[model samples]
Target: MASTTPTQIDQAPPVTSSGRSTGRAGDKIFAGLSKGSGILLLVIMASIAGFLTYRASIALSKNEGNFLTTFDWNASANPPVFGIAVLLFGTVVSSIIAMAIAVPIAVGIALFISHYAPRKLAAPIAYVVDLLAAVPSIIYGIWGALFLVPQLNGLNLWLDEYLGWTYVFDKTQVGVARSLFTVGILLAIMILPIVTSVSREVFLQVPRMNEEAALALGATRWEVIRMSVLPFGRSGVISASMLGLGRALGETMAVATVLSPSFLINGHILDPGGGTFAQNIAAKFDEANEFGRDALIASGLVLFLLTLLVNGAARLIIARRKDFSGANA
Candidate 1:
């Protein structure tokens, strides 16, 4: 074989100016596509915000009540009064309840699947969870309205009896559990699969070496998770929780179906009547006239803002703890 020399080395195949292994055309195409996709998403979001704002302004300009404080919505009335006070209360409270109930249980399920369950058990459970995530919102609404409502009366009664001192759990209404409390339980169920699936994937991504290091240090299985897995997956868990919360905040069909809609704020969550932004929009959109529709859009704008705030908060949390999120590992 010919011996290589300085001249031979210099005569080797010339690379493109960019010197990327994939060549300039491939790199440029991929970059353009990614940038374009991101731009398109932003454009769509902005369009929605603009449209909601435009319609909402029209509705607000003609409003007869304080947009923030008036308790009732009567878009069809002569003065056409409406406000989001009660709706905001219901939306925030119900979503908070959903997150409170779903997060711990979902995280536990994720941990069990990632760390404790055998592959045979985990695979089926994971598959079922994925299926649950795919189930339609309308179906969940129907299920909540029919099956879950009837079943939750006992739970409502129990909470009222024991937790009534807390005030929020006091069931003052004499009816089935078509209350914000019931809506929250239904929302918790709706968001559970989404949170669990994301958390499970995050826990599964824990570096094996890190886990082994914990074990080598005489850590128990739980201790290994506490020190190695939990820290690494904490950001991911927060992201998943925020994702679930976004859903809970905007859930329309299920809340409209299960929650007895009222225009007033009853502090007791277990009471029969309350309203949310999404539920109010969904329930009224069909029967609403042009102005009524705009009123609904105004409420939708509020829900949109709430969802954006939740996602922004999640991003901040993840950004703050990125070093411990296993990506560095």
Candidate 2:
């Protein structure tokens, strides 16, 4: 072997300084890019808000009806009359129903996939759920319109007959089940895959040591989940449910297909005469004049604000429980 000499050692390039300078340049570039991306997102959001506000103000100024209390959307009338009372009610009620139905089931399925099911079964089920999540909203709308509406008729009749005293279940007409209640059920199905997929991933992130310790303490499977899995994944579940709720709020085609859109607020959800903000906007956008278009824009503004409020609340909840979430782990 050739012996190394002082000259050879001294001839090595001064790479450390070069490397440090390159690293610093890269860091600055990355930081600047990240900051720019965030600012761009904020700018986009602000632009949307500004546009919606300007158009909505124009419509509201000329609105002959009270924007909050009036239930009729007669934008083309001699004195234009329109309000979001019925739309707000339908949107909120349908989303409430979807959340009520989807969240628990999604959580349960998540737990089952994470802890209960055998790996072979769990893999296939999870794959199927991901596929469901990818399905187009138009497909769901078509399915709801063609199949679900007719299929729900018998259930609607039963609910009306047995639960009539509840008022909400009482249907004024016995025709097709094209009511907000049916739309709620459809939205529930549409959002199911999303909530379940998020929740399953969250559950899977639970630390192995936590589950082992619980089992070592003589906890049953259910107890292990209740104590270790659930508390850790609570924030994630809330986030997933909030995402699903956002979809329910802005859903256009599916609700339009399933709900019989009218401008009346029927406290009876089983009745076929209510509408959602998105549904009404879709139903009325084409023929609406400039003022009518502005009216629709006003309704869109309400929905945009509603979605932002829901997401903000979810973020707050998630922040409060950050330690329990698996992110840090």
Candidate 3:
């Protein structure tokens, strides 16, 4: 064989004085646009939050009691004073209930869709879930009010008869399903599709190599998912839960229509008391006096804060998890 001649090497283009190449202008513009958009969003969010907080502070300053701590929602009184404690309690409780009911079912549905289900079955089911998510919230409210409420009342009645010993199932035979429990159940149903869809997407992203490796190691399907899939997708599940909580917290018409908006906060889920922030706002916005409206705004501010806190916590958890996983890897 003839001796091979050495190939010529192409010299790299010279770098600009600014440490960037001429070809990077488009990239720099794109990055600047992206960062500018993010800054604009942050500014808009901050403005809205500041306006709401300012209004809430004005309303709160006029009230006699410490608005944050007091449980009474007597915003329409002679003194025109009240607190969001009841609303906060209701919001937190209802959201917790919604997350509890939606998350497990959503995760199970996601697992089934991404892994266990046959291809033919998956498409139709996925379409159905998407359809469910697209359905108008008002439609959900009406259907929930007319259809689900009565059906649930029947279920509640059965539970009353059989499981009333448990505090959750106790019912006072109200003519309508206007309780926190009913609202929470409806919220769970409304948010289930969102959680399931997100979780399905997350689970689908689980590396094929991981699954194949587990199987090659003689792990069963369920065991493989339990070890490799779940741990990987756990952060995604938490993010989905937080997203669902945000929806549940901000939900207005559905909860308003489904629940009885009493100022009183009752520990019993079955009791016809306790009103969430969005419910309180929706129920009273039209009829509420100026003070009542401002008080509602104050309650909304709390809810906004609560949602921000929840989302932040979720992000932090995901970040820490990524860090730990990265270090391990």
Candidate 4:
């Protein structure tokens, strides 16, 4: 064989201005398409915000009630007096209750599926949980209205009897359990599968080597999970919780069905009457005139802003603790 010259061996192909070695046309096209898609999404979001703001301003200009403090929503009256105070309270309170109820159970189910259960058992359970997420919200609404509402009456009574001192649980009125508390419970059930699925995926992504190292240190299974798995998946759990909360906040039919709509912002969640933003819109939109529709849109805008704030807060929390670890070292 002939020996190759050093200059010939060192020779290389010329690169384009883009600095890509091969410079394939398809790569540039794909990159442009991805960037364009992202920009399109931002544009769409901006357009929606601007449209809602314009409509809301029109409605707010004609309002007779204090938009922030007034609890009544009488959008068809002489001056079209409407306010979001009750809606705001109901939405936030129910979502908080749902989060309080769902997150722990979801985390437990996720941990069980990821670390505790046998493979055969976990596989079926995970499949079932994912399938539950595919069920329509309408079905949950119907179920909550018919079955869950009646079933919860007993629990509501129990809470009223035992935990009545808490003020929030005090229910002096006698009626079916169609309160914000019931709505919250229904929301918890509705959001459970989504949170569980996301958390399970995050838990399953924990490195096997980290788990094994924890075990090598003579840690129990729970201890291993606490030391190696949970810390890695904490941000993911927060993300999952936020997703569930968004669903809870925006849920219309279930809250409308489970909660007997009311304009009053009572502290007794177990009492039968409260309204969420989505519930109010669904219940009132058909009866609304042109300005009333705009008023509803205003409430929708507030809901949008609330969701954005929640997501931003969650992202901030995750960013601040991105390096958190359960292990001291």
Q: What are the per-residue Cα lDDT tens digits for candidate 1 across 1-329?
A: 36768778789876554555766688899999999999999999899999999999999999999999999999878789999999999998999999999999999999999999999999999888788888898899999999999998888889999999998888787898888888889899999999999999989989899899899999999999998999889889999999999999999988998888988899888888899998998889899999999998998898899899999998888787667654543
RMSD to true structure for each model, in Å: 5.2, 3.9, 5.8, 5.5
- Model 4: residues with Cα > 4 Å off, grouped in runs: 1-32, 318-329
Return the top candidate by lDDT: 1
| Lowest lDDT 10-residue stretch of candidate 3 | 1-10
lDDT of each: 0.90, 0.89, 0.83, 0.90
Summarize candidate 4's per-residue lDDT along 1-329 as a digit string, tens digits: 24567666567544445565454788898999999999999999999999999999999999999999998988888878899999999999999999999999999999999999999999999999888788888888889989998999889989989999999999978999888898988899889999999899889978788899899999999999999899889888998898899889999987887788889998999999989999999998999999999999999999999988877877876676556633334
Full-model lDDT, candidate 4: 0.90
Residue-level lDDT for 147 in candidate 2: 98
Top of the candidates by TM-score: 2
Positional deviation of residue 191's Cα in model 1 after best superposition, in angstroms: 0.6
Rank order (by lDDT, best first): 1, 4, 2, 3
What TM-score fits each model?
0.87, 0.89, 0.85, 0.87
